[model samples]
Every structure is written in structure tokens, then in C-alpha cells.
Target: MCGGHSRGHFGHHLPMGIPVSVPVEERRSSPVDVLNERLARGEITIEEYQRMRSVLDDQYRTKHSPHIRKPTTA
Candidate 1:
């Protein structure tokens, strides 16, 4: 049993058999959060974390800022 539920029942069905619905934000971890977790777990070095974080930040800004246009391929 896990989390007080039988192994077979764990995460399978609710009391009325209704499927669990999670919000989009709750369902997925943000890229930055994942990166931070990786850093905390020693999976990435500080330098790598900084470089990847910068890339993620740039992508977020480019996607959210209307004034910033993406480069077009010829």
C-alpha cells in the first residue's frame, strides 16, 4: 500500500470512479523548475545550469514578448 491506498487502487480510481483532472500548470513542471531540481541533485554543474537557464530564459522572453520577432530561415 502506498499513501494509505492499496497498490491496485493507488492512482487508479477515485471514490466514484471519476478520472482525476489536474490543471495544466499542475500537471507539468516548468523547465526552470526541472533545471533547478537537476542542479540540486548534482546532475548538472553550476556552469551548465547557468548556460541552460540563460537559454530557457531567452526562449521564454522570445515567446512571450510580442516585440521580439523570431528569426526566419531563408
Candidate 2:
């Protein structure tokens, strides 16, 4: 069991033959949104949320910033 829900219970709701099409934006939430939700739910403290948000922001910056170049392998 996961999250107090049985695997079979989850499988029961899924359509076997039908293909489900959900937009990418609808299917996914940003990390910051998830963190905020957790904070609102009292799953994480404000301190934890701020720390994690900082880490996520740093990772995003490192990933998207062109000024930081990856070393080329010969």
C-alpha cells in the first residue's frame, strides 16, 4: 500500500482500453508550486520551504544560465 491507498484501488480507476490525453501543463506542476502546497498543508515548515525554494531556484539558474558553460570532453 502506498499513501494509505492500495495499488489495486488505484488501478481500478484507470481506463484499460481508453487512451487518456492530458495537456502537459495540466499534468504537471512546478516545483515551487508543489513546495508551496506542502507548506500550506503543514507538511513542511516555512524554514524548510524557504531552504528548498532556494535550492530549486539555484538549480534552475544553473541549468538555464548561458554564462555558466559545461566543460567539453575531447
Candidate 3:
């Protein structure tokens, strides 16, 4: 049960073909959302955005990967 944690979109209790169980047209923003919004506001350079994006991606994976790919027992 993975410590009874509910990761919403990342929950395994949901059906297949659904990434984390989020509905169509609805995707939660990563921690980089604020930075991304800033980028949209022309507050950051493309290179900086790309660089920060990579870092945030790494962070997201590190935090969520453990619970994301579970080994099923069948």
C-alpha cells in the first residue's frame, strides 16, 4: 500500500493509461511552475529556463521515483 500515501495522479489504485490518475486537460504543475510563470512573464532567459527545468526534473524524479515504479507481486 506504499505507506498508505495518496499521490493523486501518481496513485497506483487508479486505472491504466492514466498518468497518476489525473483527468484529461488537467495536470498539476511541478515546483518549477513559479519559475515557469516567471519565464512566461519574460523574467528569465531561455537558457536559464532550460537549465532550471533540468534541475527541477531531476528533483521531481528523485522525490517521486521511489513510489512511482513499484514492483508488483503476482
Candidate 4:
């Protein structure tokens, strides 16, 4: 068991047949979100931001639509 129960592995119960310790709210920011923030901060041009966003959206749809998984390195 994990979470609010016995520490099965690193103080988290195994669910989805995987060992996860971090809470959902503690996860890192998404790439798109980070890029958006940069755009808001005037660190990147809208053209560049939109291009990266399109690429990220494609990868997200391919790999993260049915099942949620960690972000890819590529």
C-alpha cells in the first residue's frame, strides 16, 4: 500500500502497477506551459512560440492521448 497507508515503496502505494512517490500537484511544468510563460515574459517571439507549440502538440497527441506517461526527451 502507498499513500495514507503502509509505505510499500518509498512511501507510496503501487498503483497502475508502477511505483510513484510524487503527488500530482508536485509534478514539473509542461513544456507548452513553460513556453507560454516565456512568451508572456517577452523572451520569445510569437512565431517561435507558435512553432514550438505546434510540435509539442503533435508529440503530445501521439504519445499522451490515451494513456498518460512521462514526457519524452526528444
* Colliding pairs, model 3: 9-20, 10-20
lDDT of 2 by residue, 1-74 (tens): 56677786645566789767778777888899899989999999999999999999878988899698656899
The candidate scoring highest on lDDT is: 1
Model 3 agreement with the true structure over 1-74: per-residue lDDT tens digits:
46677566355665777655457458776568778888999999999999998888877786888567534699
Q: For residues 4-65, what per-residue lDDT tens digits would candidate 1 score against the true structure?
A: 87777655655786778788767888899899999999999999999999999889988899
lDDT of each: 0.87, 0.84, 0.76, 0.79
lDDT of 4 by residue, 1-74 (tens): 43357564453433667765679678798898899889999999999999999999888777867576557798
Give the clash count for each candidate: 0, 0, 2, 2
Q: For candidate 2, give the lDDT.
A: 0.84
Q: Which candidate number would show the highest TM-score if scored against the true structure?
A: 1
Best of the two (1, 4) by TM-score: 1
Q: By lDDT, is 2 or 4 better?
A: 2
Q: Which stretches of candidate 3 lie over 4 Å from their true place?
A: 1-30, 66-74
Off by over 4 Å in 2: 1-26, 66-74
Candidate order, lDDT descending? 1, 2, 4, 3
Clashing pairs in 1: none
* TM values, all candidates: 0.55, 0.54, 0.46, 0.49
